[model samples]
Target: MGIKSFQGKRTTTNTKESEPILVSDYMTRNLITFKEEQPIEEVIETLIKYKISGGPVVNEKNELIGIISEGDCMKQISESRYHNLPVDKNNTVKKAMITSVETIDGNMNIFDAANKFLESKRRRFPIVENGKLVGQISQKDVLKAAMKLKSNTWK
Candidate 1:
């Protein structure tokens, strides 16, 4: 007598290749930017109004110059009090902004960008191309991208 077999037949079908997930696809294009000459007071107001922690500073030609954040504003405040100076218009973004900015390429993979954020401990990273500021990607953006791709296999 022959042994009974109950195994199902396997099917082989090629699946379509999906596009690579890039940083530019999930980055915010419309950004609230700042200028070097702008007053710290105004920057604070803008930050409050926009509910943002920081923003990138640009030149007249829209070139990436620096980055200003609440921490920078707080430093300005502390120094002002120590020096007995009022937080006035004299305190500009340039005085408080960090000139050594670290930027990422727009074409970078999202997973790589996530690794960068973890390594740098940065909330966000500005994307630069052609020596100009184009967009920004944050931790939240990476999460969103991950959620959107939840159904797809991570490779």
Candidate 2:
């Protein structure tokens, strides 16, 4: 039998009484960023190495230029295979990256972030400060924060 990896399913938490937490409270600050000029192959490798679904892409000035995800990489691979063209040096991450991204501020409440996740299909969101990427918050992180808040109330 082939081994299959299971990403945990989301279950709505009873957060009615949970206190609001900021995005920075649980966001991952150690960012794994990519350069816009980097090759798609390199991007794919980096994603795999980091075991993350997506990450922010930055310009030479360390500014967030765009974001790339596993879905985008898959689409590029599918199209390339269909076209019978190899993913060469010309195929860069910028070509496949999503330029229009929805980012959240680090100071935003976890409840707000959770609402955003429920409304959108994104698994993660980049936390920005003055238009620069600082950290990333995932749905799982929000859930964890909610659970922690719920537990703390019992103390």
Off by over 4 Å in 2: 1-19
Residue pairs in clash, model 1:
none
Residue lDDT tens for model 1, 120-155? 998889988898899999999999989888857665
lDDT of the structure predicted as candidate 2:
0.87
Clashing pairs in 2: none
Q: Quick one: how many clashes does candidate 1 have?
A: 0
Error of 1 at 142 (Å): 1.1
Give the root-mean-square deviation of each candidate in angstroms: 2.4, 14.6
Q: Candidate 1, residue 147: CA error in Å? A: 1.3
- lDDT against true structure, model 1: 0.92
- Best prediction by lDDT: 1
TM per candidate comes to: 0.88, 0.83
lDDT of each: 0.92, 0.87
What lDDT does candidate 1 reach at residue 11? Answer: 75
